[model samples]
Target: MASGKKRGKKPEVEFRNTQLADALQTQDMAAVAFALRHGPTVVPLMRPGARDDPRDTGEVWTFRDPKTGQVALLLFSDALHKPEAMPKAVGLHSPEWLRAFLEVHGDEITTVFFDIAGPHPMQASPADLIAALDA
Candidate 1:
Protein backbone atom coordinates (compact mmCIF):
# COMPACT_ATOMS: atom_id res chain seq x y z
CA MET A 1 0.00 0.00 0.00
CA ALA A 2 1.09 3.56 -0.80
CA SER A 3 0.50 6.38 1.65
CA GLY A 4 0.37 10.08 0.83
CA LYS A 5 1.43 12.20 3.78
CA LYS A 6 2.74 15.71 3.84
CA ARG A 7 5.83 16.71 5.77
CA GLY A 8 5.50 19.39 8.40
CA LYS A 9 7.20 22.70 7.85
CA LYS A 10 10.38 23.27 9.77
CA PRO A 11 10.49 26.14 12.26
CA GLU A 12 11.70 29.35 10.71
CA VAL A 13 15.23 30.45 11.59
CA GLU A 14 16.10 34.13 11.30
CA PHE A 15 19.59 35.17 10.34
CA ARG A 16 21.03 38.38 11.69
CA ASN A 17 24.46 39.96 12.01
CA THR A 18 24.54 43.66 12.76
CA GLN A 19 28.30 43.84 12.53
CA LEU A 20 28.43 42.15 9.14
CA ALA A 21 25.53 44.27 7.94
CA ASP A 22 27.37 47.41 8.98
CA ALA A 23 30.61 46.27 7.33
CA LEU A 24 28.78 45.41 4.13
CA GLN A 25 26.97 48.71 4.14
CA THR A 26 30.24 50.59 4.63
CA GLN A 27 32.08 48.35 2.09
CA ASP A 28 34.97 47.91 4.45
CA MET A 29 37.04 44.83 3.67
CA ALA A 30 38.95 45.01 6.97
CA ALA A 31 35.76 45.18 8.96
CA VAL A 32 34.32 42.39 6.85
CA ALA A 33 37.37 40.26 7.65
CA PHE A 34 37.02 41.17 11.28
CA ALA A 35 33.42 40.02 11.29
CA LEU A 36 34.39 36.77 9.59
CA ARG A 37 37.11 36.22 12.18
CA HIS A 38 34.79 36.91 15.11
CA GLY A 39 31.20 36.50 14.01
CA PRO A 40 29.53 33.13 13.12
CA THR A 41 29.92 29.90 11.15
CA VAL A 42 29.46 30.45 7.41
CA VAL A 43 28.17 27.95 4.82
CA PRO A 44 28.16 28.47 1.07
CA LEU A 45 24.89 28.43 -0.88
CA MET A 46 24.60 27.72 -4.56
CA ARG A 47 22.61 30.20 -6.60
CA PRO A 48 19.00 29.30 -7.18
CA GLY A 49 18.23 28.11 -10.73
CA ALA A 50 21.88 28.35 -11.64
CA ARG A 51 23.27 25.84 -14.09
CA ASP A 52 25.74 23.24 -12.87
CA ASP A 53 28.53 24.84 -14.83
CA PRO A 54 32.12 24.34 -13.81
CA ARG A 55 32.72 28.06 -14.16
CA ASP A 56 32.06 30.22 -11.15
CA THR A 57 29.56 33.05 -10.94
CA GLY A 58 28.45 35.11 -7.97
CA GLU A 59 29.42 33.46 -4.70
CA VAL A 60 27.09 33.21 -1.68
CA TRP A 61 27.95 31.98 1.83
CA THR A 62 25.64 31.63 4.83
CA PHE A 63 26.95 32.46 8.30
CA ARG A 64 25.42 30.69 11.26
CA ASP A 65 25.82 29.81 14.94
CA PRO A 66 24.88 26.42 16.35
CA LYS A 67 24.47 27.83 19.86
CA THR A 68 22.40 30.91 18.98
CA GLY A 69 20.94 29.45 15.74
CA GLN A 70 21.55 32.71 13.93
CA VAL A 71 22.12 32.86 10.18
CA ALA A 72 23.09 35.52 7.64
CA LEU A 73 23.94 35.73 3.98
CA LEU A 74 27.43 36.67 2.78
CA LEU A 75 27.60 37.75 -0.88
CA PHE A 76 30.79 38.30 -2.90
CA SER A 77 31.15 39.73 -6.38
CA ASP A 78 33.64 41.75 -8.34
CA ALA A 79 30.64 43.79 -9.45
CA LEU A 80 30.61 45.29 -5.97
CA HIS A 81 33.94 46.95 -6.69
CA LYS A 82 35.40 49.33 -9.22
CA PRO A 83 36.57 47.63 -12.44
CA GLU A 84 40.24 48.18 -11.74
CA ALA A 85 39.90 47.28 -8.07
CA MET A 86 37.99 44.04 -8.55
CA PRO A 87 39.32 41.16 -6.50
CA LYS A 88 41.57 39.14 -8.76
CA ALA A 89 41.78 35.98 -6.74
CA VAL A 90 40.67 34.10 -3.65
CA GLY A 91 42.68 31.59 -1.58
CA LEU A 92 39.64 29.90 -0.08
CA HIS A 93 40.01 27.06 -2.61
CA SER A 94 43.29 26.11 -1.02
CA PRO A 95 42.67 23.01 1.11
CA GLU A 96 45.35 23.78 3.69
CA TRP A 97 44.25 27.36 4.22
CA LEU A 98 40.57 26.46 4.07
CA ARG A 99 40.99 23.70 6.63
CA ALA A 100 43.00 25.91 8.93
CA PHE A 101 40.48 28.72 8.53
CA LEU A 102 37.49 26.53 9.35
CA GLU A 103 39.32 24.91 12.23
CA VAL A 104 40.39 28.23 13.73
CA HIS A 105 37.57 30.60 12.79
CA GLY A 106 34.63 28.53 11.56
CA ASP A 107 32.22 30.49 13.66
CA GLU A 108 32.97 34.06 12.61
CA ILE A 109 32.22 34.13 8.88
CA THR A 110 29.33 36.43 8.02
CA THR A 111 28.09 34.82 4.81
CA VAL A 112 27.69 31.20 3.75
CA PHE A 113 28.08 31.40 -0.01
CA PHE A 114 30.56 33.37 -2.12
CA ASP A 115 29.15 34.52 -5.46
CA ILE A 116 30.61 36.63 -8.28
CA ALA A 117 27.51 38.40 -9.55
CA GLY A 118 25.39 41.15 -8.01
CA PRO A 119 22.11 41.91 -6.17
CA HIS A 120 20.91 38.37 -5.37
CA PRO A 121 20.91 38.10 -1.60
CA MET A 122 18.59 35.52 -0.07
CA GLN A 123 18.32 33.50 3.14
CA ALA A 124 18.79 29.76 3.42
CA SER A 125 18.50 27.03 6.05
CA PRO A 126 21.56 25.20 7.32
CA ALA A 127 22.22 21.83 5.66
CA ASP A 128 24.87 19.22 4.75
CA LEU A 129 27.08 22.01 3.42
CA ILE A 130 28.09 22.77 6.98
CA ALA A 131 28.85 19.11 7.59
CA ALA A 132 31.01 19.00 4.49
CA LEU A 133 32.96 21.96 5.78
CA ASP A 134 33.35 20.35 9.16
CA ALA A 135 34.62 17.21 7.50
Candidate 2:
Protein backbone atom coordinates (compact mmCIF):
# COMPACT_ATOMS: atom_id res chain seq x y z
CA MET A 1 0.00 0.00 0.00
CA ALA A 2 3.04 2.24 -0.13
CA SER A 3 2.35 4.05 -3.32
CA GLY A 4 4.28 7.33 -3.71
CA LYS A 5 1.53 9.56 -2.37
CA LYS A 6 2.58 11.41 0.77
CA ARG A 7 -0.29 12.04 3.17
CA GLY A 8 -0.32 14.78 5.75
CA LYS A 9 -1.29 14.16 9.35
CA LYS A 10 -4.91 14.74 10.32
CA PRO A 11 -5.66 18.06 11.94
CA GLU A 12 -6.27 18.04 15.70
CA VAL A 13 -9.48 20.00 15.29
CA GLU A 14 -11.97 19.76 12.47
CA PHE A 15 -13.25 23.17 11.36
CA ARG A 16 -16.35 22.21 9.43
CA ASN A 17 -19.95 22.43 10.63
CA THR A 18 -22.46 20.37 8.67
CA GLN A 19 -25.43 22.30 10.01
CA LEU A 20 -23.97 25.61 8.95
CA ALA A 21 -23.04 24.18 5.56
CA ASP A 22 -26.58 22.91 5.05
CA ALA A 23 -28.13 26.16 6.23
CA LEU A 24 -25.94 28.07 3.81
CA GLN A 25 -27.06 25.76 1.02
CA THR A 26 -30.69 26.37 1.90
CA GLN A 27 -30.18 30.12 2.31
CA ASP A 28 -32.29 30.06 5.48
CA MET A 29 -31.65 33.08 7.65
CA ALA A 30 -32.96 31.56 10.88
CA ALA A 31 -31.07 28.31 10.42
CA VAL A 32 -27.96 30.18 9.39
CA ALA A 33 -28.22 32.37 12.47
CA PHE A 34 -28.63 29.36 14.72
CA ALA A 35 -25.70 27.59 13.15
CA LEU A 36 -23.53 30.67 13.39
CA ARG A 37 -24.31 31.14 17.05
CA HIS A 38 -23.69 27.49 17.93
CA GLY A 39 -21.02 26.28 15.54
CA PRO A 40 -17.48 27.11 14.42
CA THR A 41 -16.99 29.17 11.25
CA VAL A 42 -14.14 29.76 8.82
CA VAL A 43 -12.82 33.29 8.40
CA PRO A 44 -10.39 34.57 5.81
CA LEU A 45 -7.18 36.00 7.23
CA MET A 46 -4.71 38.61 6.09
CA ARG A 47 -1.85 36.40 7.27
CA PRO A 48 0.11 34.00 5.08
CA GLY A 49 -1.00 30.62 6.40
CA ALA A 50 -4.08 28.57 7.23
CA ARG A 51 -4.79 27.40 10.77
CA ASP A 52 -6.98 24.34 11.15
CA ASP A 53 -7.47 24.88 14.88
CA PRO A 54 -10.10 27.29 16.15
CA ARG A 55 -7.91 28.44 19.00
CA ASP A 56 -5.70 30.48 16.70
CA THR A 57 -6.96 33.95 15.81
CA GLY A 58 -5.56 36.21 13.10
CA GLU A 59 -6.19 39.48 11.34
CA VAL A 60 -9.54 38.94 9.61
CA TRP A 61 -9.82 39.96 6.01
CA THR A 62 -12.59 42.39 5.18
CA PHE A 63 -13.94 44.09 2.09
CA ARG A 64 -14.49 47.82 2.15
CA ASP A 65 -16.66 49.67 -0.31
CA PRO A 66 -14.82 52.68 -1.67
CA LYS A 67 -17.97 54.53 -2.57
CA THR A 68 -20.11 53.86 0.51
CA GLY A 69 -17.34 53.35 3.07
CA GLN A 70 -19.10 50.25 4.27
CA VAL A 71 -17.25 47.09 5.29
CA ALA A 72 -18.22 43.48 4.62
CA LEU A 73 -17.15 40.41 6.56
CA LEU A 74 -16.95 37.18 4.63
CA LEU A 75 -17.35 33.87 6.40
CA PHE A 76 -17.61 30.22 5.39
CA SER A 77 -18.87 26.98 6.93
CA ASP A 78 -15.53 25.35 6.06
CA ALA A 79 -12.15 26.63 5.00
CA LEU A 80 -12.44 24.51 1.86
CA HIS A 81 -15.50 26.51 0.86
CA LYS A 82 -13.61 29.80 0.78
CA PRO A 83 -13.48 31.42 -2.63
CA GLU A 84 -10.23 31.68 -4.57
CA ALA A 85 -10.66 35.40 -5.06
CA MET A 86 -10.40 35.86 -1.30
CA PRO A 87 -7.27 35.69 0.83
CA LYS A 88 -5.44 32.36 0.71
CA ALA A 89 -5.01 32.32 4.48
CA VAL A 90 -7.89 31.20 6.72
CA GLY A 91 -8.68 30.69 10.39
CA LEU A 92 -11.17 28.43 12.12
CA HIS A 93 -12.97 30.60 14.64
CA SER A 94 -15.30 29.56 17.47
CA PRO A 95 -18.80 30.98 18.05
CA GLU A 96 -17.60 33.04 20.98
CA TRP A 97 -14.81 34.55 18.94
CA LEU A 98 -17.24 35.40 16.19
CA ARG A 99 -19.65 37.11 18.59
CA ALA A 100 -16.88 39.21 20.13
CA PHE A 101 -15.53 40.12 16.70
CA LEU A 102 -18.93 41.32 15.53
CA GLU A 103 -19.57 43.19 18.74
CA VAL A 104 -16.31 45.07 18.29
CA HIS A 105 -16.67 45.70 14.55
CA GLY A 106 -20.47 45.92 14.31
CA ASP A 107 -20.46 49.68 13.79
CA GLU A 108 -18.06 49.54 10.84
CA ILE A 109 -19.16 46.28 9.22
CA THR A 110 -22.45 46.78 7.44
CA THR A 111 -22.75 43.43 5.67
CA VAL A 112 -21.90 39.80 6.43
CA PHE A 113 -21.55 37.36 3.57
CA PHE A 114 -21.65 33.59 3.94
CA ASP A 115 -19.78 31.69 1.24
CA ILE A 116 -19.87 34.71 -0.99
CA ALA A 117 -19.12 34.09 -4.71
CA GLY A 118 -19.91 30.45 -4.26
CA PRO A 119 -22.54 27.74 -4.63
CA HIS A 120 -24.43 28.93 -1.57
CA PRO A 121 -24.27 32.67 -1.02
CA MET A 122 -26.16 34.56 1.68
CA GLN A 123 -25.93 38.09 3.01
CA ALA A 124 -27.12 39.66 6.27
CA SER A 125 -26.80 42.92 8.10
CA PRO A 126 -24.17 43.09 10.86
CA ALA A 127 -26.78 44.35 13.35
CA ASP A 128 -29.12 41.48 12.55
CA LEU A 129 -26.31 38.96 12.77
CA ILE A 130 -25.18 40.38 16.10
CA ALA A 131 -28.72 40.20 17.44
CA ALA A 132 -29.03 36.64 16.24
CA LEU A 133 -25.80 35.73 18.00
CA ASP A 134 -27.05 37.31 21.21
CA ALA A 135 -30.35 35.45 20.97
Candidate 3:
Protein backbone atom coordinates (compact mmCIF):
# COMPACT_ATOMS: atom_id res chain seq x y z
CA MET A 1 0.00 0.00 0.00
CA ALA A 2 1.17 3.52 -0.83
CA SER A 3 0.66 6.42 1.54
CA GLY A 4 0.70 10.08 0.65
CA LYS A 5 2.27 12.44 3.18
CA LYS A 6 3.86 15.82 3.00
CA ARG A 7 7.07 16.77 4.73
CA GLY A 8 6.93 19.70 7.10
CA LYS A 9 8.84 22.90 6.45
CA LYS A 10 12.45 22.97 7.57
CA PRO A 11 13.51 25.26 10.37
CA GLU A 12 15.30 28.36 9.21
CA VAL A 13 18.85 29.19 10.27
CA GLU A 14 19.11 32.44 12.19
CA PHE A 15 21.98 34.64 11.09
CA ARG A 16 23.72 36.75 13.66
CA ASN A 17 27.31 37.65 14.56
CA THR A 18 28.01 39.15 17.93
CA GLN A 19 31.77 38.83 17.88
CA LEU A 20 32.26 40.25 14.41
CA ALA A 21 29.82 43.08 15.01
CA ASP A 22 31.61 44.05 18.20
CA ALA A 23 34.98 43.71 16.53
CA LEU A 24 33.88 46.05 13.74
CA GLN A 25 32.74 48.63 16.24
CA THR A 26 36.04 48.62 18.14
CA GLN A 27 38.15 48.29 15.00
CA ASP A 28 39.85 45.31 16.56
CA MET A 29 41.82 43.67 13.77
CA ALA A 30 42.70 40.56 15.74
CA ALA A 31 39.16 40.05 16.96
CA VAL A 32 37.80 40.70 13.49
CA ALA A 33 40.24 38.13 12.10
CA PHE A 34 39.18 35.60 14.68
CA ALA A 35 35.51 36.29 14.03
CA LEU A 36 35.89 35.99 10.29
CA ARG A 37 37.58 32.64 10.70
CA HIS A 38 35.00 31.25 13.12
CA GLY A 39 31.72 33.02 12.57
CA PRO A 40 29.05 33.22 9.87
CA THR A 41 29.13 36.18 7.48
CA VAL A 42 26.35 38.05 5.73
CA VAL A 43 26.64 38.34 1.97
CA PRO A 44 24.28 40.17 -0.38
CA LEU A 45 22.88 38.20 -3.27
CA MET A 46 21.69 39.03 -6.77
CA ARG A 47 18.79 37.18 -8.35
CA PRO A 48 17.98 36.85 -12.01
CA GLY A 49 14.34 37.66 -11.43
CA ALA A 50 11.74 37.98 -8.74
CA ARG A 51 12.16 35.22 -6.16
CA ASP A 52 9.74 32.47 -7.05
CA ASP A 53 11.25 29.74 -4.90
CA PRO A 54 12.05 29.92 -1.22
CA ARG A 55 15.13 27.71 -1.55
CA ASP A 56 16.98 29.93 -3.94
CA THR A 57 20.45 31.16 -2.87
CA GLY A 58 21.21 33.92 -5.30
CA GLU A 59 24.63 34.89 -6.62
CA VAL A 60 26.90 36.96 -4.38
CA TRP A 61 26.78 40.70 -4.92
CA THR A 62 30.06 42.45 -5.81
CA PHE A 63 31.22 45.88 -6.86
CA ARG A 64 33.59 46.65 -9.71
CA ASP A 65 35.49 49.88 -9.84
CA PRO A 66 34.86 51.80 -13.04
CA LYS A 67 38.29 53.33 -13.30
CA THR A 68 40.52 50.38 -12.37
CA GLY A 69 38.03 47.64 -13.19
CA GLN A 70 38.97 46.09 -9.88
CA VAL A 71 36.44 44.11 -7.90
CA ALA A 72 35.68 44.32 -4.17
CA LEU A 73 33.94 41.75 -2.01
CA LEU A 74 31.66 43.26 0.62
CA LEU A 75 31.10 41.35 3.83
CA PHE A 76 28.84 42.20 6.75
CA SER A 77 28.73 40.99 10.33
CA ASP A 78 24.93 41.06 10.27
CA ALA A 79 22.24 40.97 7.60
CA LEU A 80 20.41 43.93 9.12
CA HIS A 81 23.47 46.11 8.54
CA LYS A 82 23.35 45.74 4.78
CA PRO A 83 22.82 49.06 3.03
CA GLU A 84 19.77 49.88 0.89
CA ALA A 85 21.88 50.38 -2.23
CA MET A 86 22.83 46.71 -2.30
CA PRO A 87 20.64 43.83 -3.45
CA LYS A 88 17.60 43.18 -1.33
CA ALA A 89 18.57 39.55 -0.83
CA VAL A 90 21.03 38.42 1.82
CA GLY A 91 22.49 35.07 2.87
CA LEU A 92 24.29 33.86 5.96
CA HIS A 93 27.26 31.79 4.93
CA SER A 94 29.62 29.74 7.07
CA PRO A 95 33.36 30.19 7.45
CA GLU A 96 33.88 27.41 4.93
CA TRP A 97 31.94 29.40 2.35
CA LEU A 98 34.16 32.41 3.04
CA ARG A 99 37.30 30.40 2.51
CA ALA A 100 35.99 28.88 -0.68
CA PHE A 101 34.83 32.24 -2.02
CA LEU A 102 38.18 33.84 -1.33
CA GLU A 103 40.03 30.92 -2.86
CA VAL A 104 37.97 31.02 -6.03
CA HIS A 105 37.67 34.79 -6.40
CA GLY A 106 40.96 35.87 -4.92
CA ASP A 107 42.42 36.71 -8.29
CA GLU A 108 39.53 38.91 -9.29
CA ILE A 109 38.92 40.57 -5.93
CA THR A 110 41.55 43.12 -5.08
CA THR A 111 40.10 44.47 -1.84
CA VAL A 112 37.66 43.13 0.72
CA PHE A 113 35.45 45.51 2.70
CA PHE A 114 33.89 44.94 6.10
CA ASP A 115 30.80 46.96 6.95
CA ILE A 116 31.56 48.96 3.84
CA ALA A 117 28.80 51.60 3.88
CA GLY A 118 29.33 53.10 7.34
CA PRO A 119 29.84 52.61 11.07
CA HIS A 120 33.54 51.76 11.09
CA PRO A 121 34.33 50.50 7.62
CA MET A 122 37.49 48.43 7.20
CA GLN A 123 39.37 47.22 4.17
CA ALA A 124 41.85 44.40 3.62
CA SER A 125 43.57 42.81 0.70
CA PRO A 126 42.26 39.51 -0.57
CA ALA A 127 45.70 38.02 0.10
CA ASP A 128 45.55 39.14 3.71
CA LEU A 129 42.06 37.69 4.21
CA ILE A 130 43.14 34.43 2.63
CA ALA A 131 46.02 34.22 5.05
CA ALA A 132 43.67 34.82 7.95
CA LEU A 133 41.35 32.11 6.70
CA ASP A 134 44.27 29.78 6.39
CA ALA A 135 45.32 30.58 9.94
Candidate 4:
Protein backbone atom coordinates (compact mmCIF):
# COMPACT_ATOMS: atom_id res chain seq x y z
CA MET A 1 0.00 0.00 0.00
CA ALA A 2 3.03 2.27 0.24
CA SER A 3 3.20 2.64 -3.51
CA GLY A 4 0.54 4.79 -5.23
CA LYS A 5 -1.11 2.15 -7.34
CA LYS A 6 -3.53 2.88 -10.17
CA ARG A 7 -7.20 2.04 -9.38
CA GLY A 8 -10.46 1.41 -11.23
CA LYS A 9 -11.31 1.96 -14.92
CA LYS A 10 -11.90 5.73 -14.71
CA PRO A 11 -8.44 6.77 -13.40
CA GLU A 12 -6.56 7.82 -10.27
CA VAL A 13 -6.50 11.52 -9.55
CA GLU A 14 -3.73 13.19 -7.60
CA PHE A 15 -5.67 14.68 -4.67
CA ARG A 16 -4.23 17.97 -3.55
CA ASN A 17 -4.50 19.62 -0.11
CA THR A 18 -7.98 20.98 -0.87
CA GLN A 19 -9.93 17.95 -2.09
CA LEU A 20 -8.48 15.78 0.66
CA ALA A 21 -10.18 17.91 3.33
CA ASP A 22 -13.73 17.00 2.34
CA ALA A 23 -12.97 13.29 2.33
CA LEU A 24 -11.55 13.49 5.85
CA GLN A 25 -14.32 15.62 7.33
CA THR A 26 -17.92 16.19 6.21
CA GLN A 27 -18.99 13.05 8.01
CA ASP A 28 -20.47 11.84 11.31
CA MET A 29 -17.62 9.83 12.75
CA ALA A 30 -14.78 11.52 14.67
CA ALA A 31 -11.81 12.96 12.78
CA VAL A 32 -9.65 9.87 13.31
CA ALA A 33 -12.36 7.46 12.26
CA PHE A 34 -13.19 9.58 9.23
CA ALA A 35 -9.60 9.57 8.03
CA LEU A 36 -9.43 5.83 8.49
CA ARG A 37 -12.58 5.54 6.39
CA HIS A 38 -10.96 7.21 3.37
CA GLY A 39 -7.68 5.40 3.81
CA PRO A 40 -7.62 2.15 1.85
CA THR A 41 -5.35 0.47 4.40
CA VAL A 42 -3.19 1.37 7.39
CA VAL A 43 0.54 0.76 6.96
CA PRO A 44 2.37 0.87 10.27
CA LEU A 45 5.79 2.47 9.71
CA MET A 46 6.99 3.86 13.08
CA ARG A 47 6.37 2.85 16.68
CA PRO A 48 6.20 4.50 20.14
CA GLY A 49 9.39 4.80 22.28
CA ALA A 50 11.58 2.92 19.84
CA ARG A 51 14.72 5.06 19.91
CA ASP A 52 16.37 7.87 21.91
CA ASP A 53 16.83 10.45 19.20
CA PRO A 54 14.30 13.32 19.34
CA ARG A 55 13.66 13.03 15.60
CA ASP A 56 12.77 9.37 15.98
CA THR A 57 9.30 9.45 17.56
CA GLY A 58 8.75 5.69 17.29
CA GLU A 59 5.69 6.53 15.19
CA VAL A 60 4.61 4.16 12.44
CA TRP A 61 2.48 4.47 9.26
CA THR A 62 1.26 2.41 6.32
CA PHE A 63 1.64 3.25 2.65
CA ARG A 64 -0.20 6.09 0.92
CA ASP A 65 -4.00 6.21 0.97
CA PRO A 66 -5.76 3.51 -1.10
CA LYS A 67 -8.90 5.68 -1.59
CA THR A 68 -11.26 2.99 -0.41
CA GLY A 69 -15.02 3.54 -0.22
CA GLN A 70 -15.04 4.30 3.50
CA VAL A 71 -12.60 7.16 3.19
CA ALA A 72 -9.78 8.51 1.03
CA LEU A 73 -6.19 8.57 2.30
CA LEU A 74 -5.73 11.66 4.48
CA LEU A 75 -2.09 12.23 5.39
CA PHE A 76 -0.82 14.10 8.51
CA SER A 77 2.61 14.61 10.05
CA ASP A 78 4.65 16.97 12.31
CA ALA A 79 7.92 17.69 10.44
CA LEU A 80 6.69 20.89 8.79
CA HIS A 81 9.54 22.49 6.85
CA LYS A 82 8.63 25.28 4.41
CA PRO A 83 5.84 24.05 2.12
CA GLU A 84 5.89 20.21 2.30
CA ALA A 85 8.87 18.03 3.02
CA MET A 86 8.28 15.07 0.81
CA PRO A 87 9.96 11.64 0.97
CA LYS A 88 10.95 12.46 4.52
CA ALA A 89 9.98 11.20 7.96
CA VAL A 90 6.36 10.14 8.60
CA GLY A 91 3.79 11.05 11.26
CA LEU A 92 0.05 11.10 11.91
CA HIS A 93 -1.43 12.66 8.76
CA SER A 94 -4.72 13.00 10.64
CA PRO A 95 -8.10 13.34 8.95
CA GLU A 96 -8.58 16.75 10.54
CA TRP A 97 -5.54 18.09 8.76
CA LEU A 98 -6.65 16.58 5.48
CA ARG A 99 -10.01 18.35 5.70
CA ALA A 100 -8.47 21.65 6.70
CA PHE A 101 -5.87 21.47 3.94
CA LEU A 102 -8.47 20.67 1.28
CA GLU A 103 -10.81 23.45 2.44
CA VAL A 104 -7.96 25.89 1.97
CA HIS A 105 -6.26 24.64 -1.22
CA GLY A 106 -8.72 22.44 -3.10
CA ASP A 107 -8.10 24.35 -6.33
CA GLU A 108 -4.34 23.83 -6.47
CA ILE A 109 -4.64 20.03 -6.84
CA THR A 110 -4.65 18.53 -10.35
CA THR A 111 -6.85 15.57 -11.37
CA VAL A 112 -5.18 12.77 -13.36
CA PHE A 113 -6.80 9.49 -12.35
CA PHE A 114 -9.14 9.42 -15.36
CA ASP A 115 -6.17 9.50 -17.70
CA ILE A 116 -2.61 8.28 -17.49
CA ALA A 117 -0.03 9.55 -14.95
CA GLY A 118 0.92 12.44 -17.23
CA PRO A 119 -0.96 14.94 -19.43
CA HIS A 120 -3.55 15.85 -16.78
CA PRO A 121 -4.22 15.13 -13.14
CA MET A 122 -7.60 13.89 -11.88
CA GLN A 123 -9.23 13.69 -8.47
CA ALA A 124 -8.91 9.98 -7.78
CA SER A 125 -12.41 8.58 -7.42
CA PRO A 126 -13.47 5.96 -4.83
CA ALA A 127 -14.01 3.31 -7.48
CA ASP A 128 -10.62 4.09 -9.02
CA LEU A 129 -8.89 3.35 -5.73
CA ILE A 130 -10.78 0.06 -5.33
CA ALA A 131 -9.76 -1.04 -8.82
CA ALA A 132 -6.17 -0.11 -8.15
CA LEU A 133 -6.16 -2.24 -5.00
CA ASP A 134 -7.63 -5.16 -6.94
CA ALA A 135 -4.98 -4.72 -9.64
TM values, all candidates: 0.28, 0.81, 0.81, 0.25
- Residue-level lDDT tens digits of model 1 in 20-133: 456666656555555444444222334422347534433533445788876544334322321223333221232233345445444554434433232333222223224443
What stretches of model 3 exceed 4 Å from their correct place?
A: 1-13, 48-57
lDDT of 4 by residue, 16-93 (tens): 333223333442224323333344221123454345665543443322334742332323311221123233444433
> Clash totals for all models, in order?
23, 0, 0, 32
Displacement of the residue 91 alpha carbon in candidate 1, Å? 21
Error of 4 at 15 (Å): 20
RMSD of each: 14.9, 4.9, 4.3, 17.2
lDDT, model 3:
0.84
Better of 1 and 4 by lDDT: 1
lDDT value for model 4: 0.33
Tens digits of lDDT, candidate 2, 17-133: 788999988888899989988888888999734348545577899999999988999998888788788879877777889889999998889899988876788999888888888
Best candidate according to lDDT: 2
| lDDT of candidates 1 onward, in order | 0.40, 0.85, 0.84, 0.33
